[model samples]
Target chain A: MTNPGIRDDDVLKAAEQWRREGRGVAIATVVQTWGSAPRPVGSHLVIDDKQNFLGSVSGGCIEGEVIVNAGEVIESGKPRLLEFGVADETAWRAGLSCGGNIRIYVQRVD
Target chain B: MRLDLLADLNAERAARRGAVVVTDLADGSQRMLRENEAASDALLKSLNVRLRGSKSGVHEHGGKKFFVELHRPPLRIVVTGAVHVSQAMAPMAKLLGYDIVIIDPRDAFATPARFPDVQLIVGWPDNALPSLALDPWTAFAAITHDPKIDNPALKLALDAGCFYVGALGSKKTHARRVEALKQMGVSEAKIASIHAPIGLDIGALSPPEIALAILAEITLYLRKGEEASA
Candidate 1:
């Protein structure tokens, strides 16, 4: 039987492979969530410097911004803790329609 | 983010062994701890507890927060009888993310057409159970009432520490089966572990419903770490 958590593992494995292949990679993980979050706290999204990505951290509500920030993290070799919610000023502009709060921790894996 | 650590973790997963990856949330330093090392590693004591429950979470320890990711082997079910109940149970278990293997010596009954997309072993329990290497992640069901087929398999499953062991029979049949198990020198606690008359008492009248009840019982045991009757 296929392992139910294989997708999560696959994302990590892909990140490692991308790094080994000389492509800068970063991973964004949902470290915390409050009410009505589409994904769980441990959900992940792995992104490469070329904008290729795998997995999801917020279903579809906040990935576009996370992916953009991930590219910056890859280039800077720095980490970021990004928070989004209806309480944030960019919520409506970023289309965080889930009406919940999420904290994403992004870091360069290489 | 260590390649060697990832390689070792992959190897453990490929071998169907459980492990936990603890990632330091501060700097992204990661470490993989295998099942055997969890007992002696002070840093892994709390992680080991989560691993036993098959859970993953973020926790704070020593002023550092870590993300503990659990990687458990796939759940497996071994059915001793290729009877009608096995037909219904195998597919349902598969849908619930269980790897299924059906064993029955009767070639006519244990066929590809009847149990499509499942591992079929046309062999007796004595030989088949050993080859399968039953472990804590596996659940065993003896649906065949025949003593010759069910008795040996139940013994092996209990001895191997399978998480769940169920037998199918009426009250009288179960009593006789218990006596026979005693004759084979099975301990009282081990014999008590068997869920006789198998499945939850859901008032099931047909083979498919009975199969559903059995799967329900197995799921309850797996999730709650205890038996549920109805």
Candidate 2:
């Protein structure tokens, strides 16, 4: 419960609220990592059916992508795997300028 | 706006070994998002077609088939000592999102200035335990080196099913403390839960480093439990 530099618990609570409204929710977990990523492994970002966001998987870079794809997760009731790397120019466009590799697992939950 | 229903959804999902995510869609737009999978792509397409045909942008997903709950419990911590270590620890704990409460009998040590935001109690363990109201989810740490302060607090924590319970002392000190507790009729099994010689072996020398080690160990325990369940 005591974590340094984490606050605004409301964000997480808000994400939880959206899930209860019968919206498909997905949890994006940072499982594997390499190089200098903004967030470390075990970081979490959640998206609900309403496209509401909670937590942070990437500092900002990957959240938009995860949220955009999470909408599809709500519809299909399936999970997804997403990856972003420093080598990709398009990923740089998404805001991941750190040039490290990170893996995200998006699992659909109630 | 709608907090209770969201909390319920999260509870349901957690019960089912699942997780929750939320999104926001504004007015006058389809807000249709692409899926990462083929089947979901087709499904979203159909859903978009249906929504576009109906011209309604606001709706729940698939007759509530998924549990997208939104509730988070407040993080709580009970520090059983208002000594200098606890003084240094309280603000850091607050920064980490914990509702910190301090218990100690010494009025000089447990005052408002030392811990401005924390709930300070000027009472011994026996007097404090009843009113503190700890639960299974709460994290407890016995920072007092004294047996009178640490022992009763440890008893309360073990009884309440706290998620984390740690104490400060050397390995030898902890062993002696445990032996003392057994003499006081505390069970051998319950005595095992205390993380004596508290904090990780990070070669911490100062009070702050010691606090960091303690915080890190608590995080490890919690995260490990989370992974086990997930």
Candidate 3:
């Protein structure tokens, strides 16, 4: 569970709560996807500055990479767009393994 | 998104209203549009199509890329019965991501043992229906059979503009129900809106099969009713 009273799947609510707690937080959303995507577009992954995170932008495909990028987004207070595809050399390591392409938008919660 | 706008979007969601957050990927500029306010938007045509499908994605227009994040309220199933069919429907509704509420005045039938992990309302329809706050995203099914229980709830649901209103009854039983609703002063249009002999014509016999049929009918209305009407 994300918190005591919120639903486990409510990523926005969880992100808002983390922001209220005075944490440097970033919300990464799956803005676009193509070909056998793991998670649908609009799925969210909330990451705090301390690396604590919840929700998912993929089916565990590129979330670790998103968290890494989110650290910069949180520090800069600017949004960044990230793209990963199976064709990329990082496909097996940091990219989608299921032959899919996805774009994630990581924005700091203000 | 600005802090006030984020709070506004969350408030809209908490009130069960659909909100569309449009973000400019180029500069991180953003604006939140509520469902009700979408009609006046310049992008209403595209937004209407997307919202009808309940989707969220990037929309490209005039060389600008905008991520339209559509957030809609969770669907609800409010059943005015704790009968065998309601028992069968609880799990299916939950599986379909609907918040199911089973209402029955009879304590024995509305017991927790019969319906687990479902919102069970043990009270009369007049007393319980108001608190549920039936809305357009809700599908109301009155399977109680007793007019005393179903009639009032049906009136409330229809008046509240529930997306789907179904009552379990035969043609003859529904004829009687129609007369009773008329006597209660419900509008002719509203009374005519009840889906009699509820559920799709799936020729269902068992309770679970009937539950499947009802849910199928509700899904049809919920998803395709807009296109059908348009």
Best by lDDT: 3
The best candidate in terms of TM-score: 3
Instruction: Return the lDDT, model 2, position B47.
Output: 48
Tens digit per residue, CA lDDT, model 3, A32-95: 8999988778778889999999888777878889999999999999899998998788756885
lDDT of 2 by residue, B97-194 (tens): 67788999988888998888789988898888777677655788988788789888888888887778888988888888888888888788788878
lDDT of each: 0.83, 0.66, 0.86
Q: Which lDDT tens digits does candidate 1 get at residues B6-44?
A: 668767876768787778888877888898875466877
Across A15-96, the per-residue lDDT of candidate 1 in tens digits comes to 7788889898888988778888878766789999989998888768789999999999988987887889988889657777
Candidate 3, superposed: residue stretches over 4 Å from native: A1-9, B46-54, B228-230
lDDT for each residue of candidate 3 in B46-162, tens digit (9 for 90 to 100): 545355466788888778888888777778999999999999999888777788999999998999999987899999999998988888879999999999999999999999999
Query: In model 1, which regions exceed 4 Å deviation?
Result: A1-31, A41-50, A54-63, A76-101, A104-109, B44-48, B226-230
Local lDDT at A64 for model 3: 87
Ranking, lDDT, top scorer first: 3, 1, 2
- Which docking class does model 3 fall in? acceptable
- What fraction of the correct interface contacts does each predicted structure contain? 0.27, 0.22, 0.51
- When 1 and 2 are scored with DockQ, the better candidate is 1
lDDT of 3 at B229: 38
